[model samples]
Target: MLQIYNTLSRSKQGFKPIEPGKVKMYVCGMTVYDFCHIGHARVMIVFDMVVRWLRTSGYEVLYVRNITDIDDKIINRAIENGEPISVLTNRFIDAMHADSDELGLMHPDQEPRATDYISQMQGMIGTLIENELAYQANDGDVNFAVRLLPRYGQLSDKTLDELNAGERVAVADGKRDPLDFVLWKSAKPEKPAGTLWSSPWGKGRPGWHIECSAMSCDILGEHFDIHGGGADLQFPHHENEIAQSEGALYGKDRKDDDAPFVNYWMHNGHIRVNEEKMSKSLGNFFLIRDVLKSFDPEVLRFFMLKAHYRSPINYSDAQLEEARAGLVRLYTALAQPAPKVLETALDPNNPWAQRFAGAMNDDFNTPEAIAVLFDLASEVNRAQGDEKQLLANLLRSLAATLNFLQREPTEFLQAGAKDQAGLTAELIEERIAARVAAKQAKDFAQADLMRKALLEQGIVLEDKPGGLTEWRRA
Candidate 1:
């Protein structure tokens, strides 16, 4: 049985699917105001590994991550840029998807947008209102009365008074209680917004917290097997979702008398840059695309998993190069040619693979599992002769262990340095071709001078192995 460190339970609980063979999962997605960063990549890759491992263990997973295109940030951005909300959100979403693809994150089975489920959100709010768990304030804003909900502090372990004490209670005279959070916001006359929904209350947009609740319930039912997100959203975000959904969904669909939202709560740790958490305010932040420009996505993925998923990782260039070299070692082991045919079966004597599986079985300990892979790779590199079969087995088994290592050994072995050299070689080849043409024109002085210059510069031309002039650094 697999054990997952559930955030809500605050314990590593044995994972039992709500339904026998299927895993229902929903991961909170990007807000679409800006491009995805390494922080987002950490969550995406972590959960992806979770999903892959679950599938490997013979369970079907249904994953849903939502797109929060409608929110305060999106509205603020749209107004600032003087662009339509759709235009701004669409551009950012495209960039976000591109980053996700580059990072090798699997697309969720269903990626519902918040705008598509306005009616569902309003209906849930209506249910909350009717149940006296929520109310529409005099200002036409739908608010979740956290004080009215039973065990309101269960998820975050924060009392209603504690939350109110921590936060500067905004002087919204419309709300009767300080703990009540917005479910729907009434549009103000001064704000020029692009999206509007017609509701019994008034004209307004769905609150940030309401979108996920509505989207999740519409697709995955009142409850799911797991609800995952970054650790930062544990407070008002996930907390409010639990209260609103339980009050609204469980009441409507009495069959799910237990919980209205999710069975398991998984949150990935933060991404730091040199021991400081990457935040815009701290100026220690990087966009995913910018990071990818300097390093391969696989290397980034590998660096992330080096530490446990729930533990913070402080990234730096040195750490990245270390990961790059480590990945190269694995690929080098894979590249060694094998004997004619080898049995595909696991070697009962191969303790390395067992170690890998053992680590993985222990709550997806990827760092230890990776250590096992590296150990096997070292053994493979040290072996000669009929070790081809061993290398082949490693090539296959490592893929099962690390999804990022799906490339053929030779392809994967090419480091970023080599790719840079290849580009330089291409330019040199163009220079050589131009030089050859110059020589063919019978400009003896230019040819002699060029040939001498080439020899002086360490470009020793000879009958090369591939019948093409190849050059290597001296």
Candidate 2:
């Protein structure tokens, strides 16, 4: 049985989906106002690992991640750049896809857009108003009646009496209470082209809370198994979702027929920079692309999993460089030539892979799993005559099952920027020329030196049945 840390229960609960052979998962996605950062990658990669392990253990997982195409941030960014809101969000969405692809996150089974589900959102808002769960003011702005929803503060552990948002109460004719959040914000005359939809209340845009509710219900069903996001979303966002979803279903008088919403909730820890909180005001934020320019994706993954998913990750250049160096050792060990893989499950004469599997099975402890990988590397480097091939094959086969060590051995051994072999054809030609000059001048010493340097850097030279020195990345 697989056990997972459920944030809702705050425990490692056994995973049993409502359906027999399937699992449903929903992850809150990017707002599409800016490039994705390492914090976003933490959530994405953590969930990707979750899905991968579920599939590895024989569960059919239908993963859905939503794109918040419309939000205050998106509109402001549009205005700042002098572009249409649609154009701005689309550009960021494309950037999101590229970054997700680079970081190795699996494409979600469904990616619902907020703009496409405004009708559903409006319908939910109307139900809330009818059931006294919400109310609309004179200005046509609808707000969620927090006091009416008895479980308003349950998810965030806040009390209804002390609901403090640190913002002053505004005098709006439509709102009955101050704690009530806007379910639909009435479009103002000044902002003509931001976004708006016709609802019972008035022409307005859906609030942040309603977007997730409508999108999740529309795609995954009225109820689903898991709802996950960053740790920061536990409060108002998720709290509001639980209220609107369950309240709407109950208000329809389908108490029993109401689909049970997310049975489990999961959240990954935040990413910090050098132990300092990464924020725009602090000027310490780094986009994932900028970080990727200096480091390999796998090294970043290893760095992330080094700490438990629930623990904060402190990012720094030194930490990533160290991870890269350590990763090289393991990948190189697997990248060595593999003999024929044995058909059946046996001891395999190496305990590293078995140790890895056992660690992975125990509550998806990737840190422990990675420790096993390091142990395998230690064993490989220490092994002599009889033990080498068995350990190498074990590492290769295990990595095939778990994608942590997939790169070819040559690629794995590369350490620094210098490890990149021959950046251009001109560099290759120059290196070749140096080698030829050394050999022709009878300075065989220099020629042999250049060849060894190239080989060490992962450039394999072949004196192929052709008279030319053929070269390729190993």
lDDT of 1 by residue, 19-137 (tens): 99999999999889998888988888998888887777778899889999988788888999999999998999899889988887788898898998999999988888888887788
Candidate 1: the clashing residue pairs are none
Candidate 2 residues 287-357, lDDT tens each? 98988886777778778877788888888988887777777667656543443454223253446656765
Give each model's whole-structure lDDT.
0.77, 0.76
Score every model by TM-score: 0.85, 0.84
Q: Candidate 1: list runs displaced more than 4 Å.
A: 165-171, 250-257, 338-353, 417-474
lDDT of 2: 0.76
Q: In model 2, what is the error at residue 247, expressed in angstroms?
A: 1.1
Q: What is the lDDT of residue 54 in candidate 2?
A: 77
Model 1 scores worst on lDDT over the 10 consecutive residues at 338-347
| Residue pairs clashing, model 2 | 137-174, 335-409
TM-score of candidate 1 to 2 decimals: 0.85
